[model samples]
Target: MLGANASKNSTLTLVFLAALKGVVGFYSGSSVLIADAVHTSLDIFASFAVWVGLKLSLKDSAEKFPYGYYKADNLVSLFVSIIILFSGVELVREALLNITNPVGMKLQGIALGTAVFSVITMYGLSKYKARVGRLIDSQALIADAIHSYTDVFSSLIVVITIVGSMLGIKWLDSVGVLVISLMIFKLGTGIARDSVLTLMDAWLDKDSITRIRQNVGSIQGVKTVGEIRLRKSGLVVFGEIEIEIEGDTNLKRVDMLSEEIEKIVKNEVKNLEHLVVNAKPGKMSVMKIAVPVLMQEGLHSKVSGHFGRAPYFIFIELEDGKIKSWDISENPASDLEKKRGMKTTEFLKNRGVNVLIVGEIGEGPFHMLRDSFVKMLQMPEVVEDVEKVVEKVSELSTLTAPTE
Candidate 1:
């Protein structure tokens, strides 16, 4: 809203000023003022283009444009640059022709006053446009701001021509045209350069890329940030990243890791519209194992007589084959009349259980376990102690081999 209003206000004011310049220049017969008046027409056109682009750019993604219309801002900016460039070329040719054959005129006071008023008005418009442009991160507004600002410089050149004519220097009006033409040309070229680079999908910026890496680098299970890319349009930025995780990690865990990375990066980076995090399988040391037991026994405790009916279970966390930590919690569904096995399997899966060690598991939970990719080791008989059970699980499950 702010950007739209700013563009509208600035363009309208330029239109009014251009009208004043055209009428005044025609009466005063100053080629500089006349060319400047014509140039303001493009300013209005460019401003409208930018306004439409920004409006469309803010729209949501549609089936036809899956990536959204963010590129509209840059595209319009590029088109506006062409408008200014062509206007400048025409202005240069006119200025050269006027210089070759000077058109003398009865100097009118209205022209001088109009030139001064235009300079003041355009300067004000540029400042307003600049404030609104930065506020909303609108590329179109910024480009338009530049165009209006250069018009102020050209207006000042017209003032010089008027003063020179008053001082009886016949050629200064034509000389003013040459300087204004160059100014307009330079402005067009600079804007075009930036628009083309953005359209080409150039790197956003070094600082922004660093911030993205910093956000994703510290996430758990993200072994390495393999690739990070962001493409910016208008105020929005789209990103994609590749992260390395353990090759043995379950699919469910990988999914969780991918979501975590996306969340962290989006929260940290400003205006990141959407992020796609690809979890590349690699090797790492994070692993967990769970065993159902009748009691809360110590690390080397004995296994329970049954799987789902175990009153308590011990969850062991290991890093690089060595025990890191362990916890015991009561199995809430042990006394349930139905679905106890499935419920217990869910409980273990939520606790990051990669492998399950049990004496035996029912068919229903067994299928659920297989679907969740939980490595199950059904010992033929209950083990005498946890040490024996751990040894058997480490050897049987094709995950990490726990060290002695």
Candidate 2:
């Protein structure tokens, strides 16, 4: 709505300026001012096109157009570019004729005043439209803004031409028209290129994709980050991501993980209108199991009764149902005064611990670990030897059910 309003107002302003310049240019025989009037006249149509595009782009999606009418703005911008290029060609012809056959000029004071007024008006209007366009991310309005800015330059040239003609430099008017024509051609091609790219559905830049991947990877239960695709439509961005998870993960857990991923991506990325997350189950070839222990005793450590207060954690790396490697590390958050369970849960997560075996667990840590997708199993009794625990866990058939 803001963009539409800006376009409408600018169109009305252009109508008045075009009329004023056209009348004064003919009376004073200022060819440069007349050419500038033609350019301003074209801007009226360009601004009107922007207004229509912004209005149509806001329509809701229907059966015929599942993606909505967002591309209308790009189409309108392309149309405006064509108008600019056409006007540039016309100006080139007029400049050549004026140069080949110089005409006597009657420089009226009204012509110079009108040209000065146009410069000020167009400069202000250009700034206003550019601000509104950026605020709404409207390409059509931005294109119109560029058009208005070029008018300012053209009008400035008119002022110079009128003053020089009054001082006996009549040929300056022809050269001024030539220069404005070249500038208009350049601006038209640039806008046309951008409009074409957007219409083609170009991918988002690498930095945005990388940031999204990093955010998704930080979430728990995500084993691997797969392909990520994103594209822009008008002012909004749409994305799709593929993620890998444990093969045995339940449907409810998968849904929860998907929701988490969508939430994080939307929060971290700007202007994201929609996201589709694909969570695929992955085969478990290896397992990283963490056991809370009372002390660092290699495979001889005793299981700690309290998860948060455990002095150390023993990590066992198992492959193909066999213990491949084991390591014991002191728990850094064991002696924390507050949030010890939460901190310890984060610590294990950063170490890529997928399974946690404990004799007991506090409610806070239990839920935290569960949300992290860390499989928790309660020991039947206090075990004195970590070696026996490892042997029992290695047997796929004798493993106990996960803790509730």
Name the best candidate (by lDDT): 2
In model 2, what lDDT does residue 334 have? Answer: 94
Instruction: Predict model 2's lDDT versus the native.
Output: 0.81
lDDT of 1 at 224: 76
* Candidate 2 weakest ten by summed lDDT: 395-404
Error of 2 at 123 (Å): 0.9
Clashing pairs in 1: 247-282, 301-386
- The residue ranges of model 2 lying beyond 4 angstroms of the native Cα positions read 214-224, 244-270, 281-286, 291-314, 327-352, 357-362, 377-404
Quote the lDDT for 122 in model 1: 91
Q: Candidate 1 overall Cα lDDT vs. reference?
A: 0.76
Candidate 1: tens digits of C-alpha lDDT, residues 1-404: 78878877876887898898888888888777788888888788888988888888878989999988999988998988888788778766766776676665555577788889989999999889988888877777888888878778777877877777787775665666677778888889988988898888776477866776777777654557887887777667778888776434566776777777777776666677788877765653655778877666676666786777888888877777777888888988899888888788888878877667766677777756655656666554535776567655557644232211
TM agreement with the true structure for every prediction: 0.68, 0.79
Question: What is the Å distance of residue 290 in model 2 from its true position?
Answer: 2.7
- Each prediction's number of clashing residue pairs: 2, 0
Q: For model 2, what is the error of residue 33's alpha carbon versus the real structure, in angstroms, after optimal superposition? A: 2.7
lDDT of 1 at 240: 84
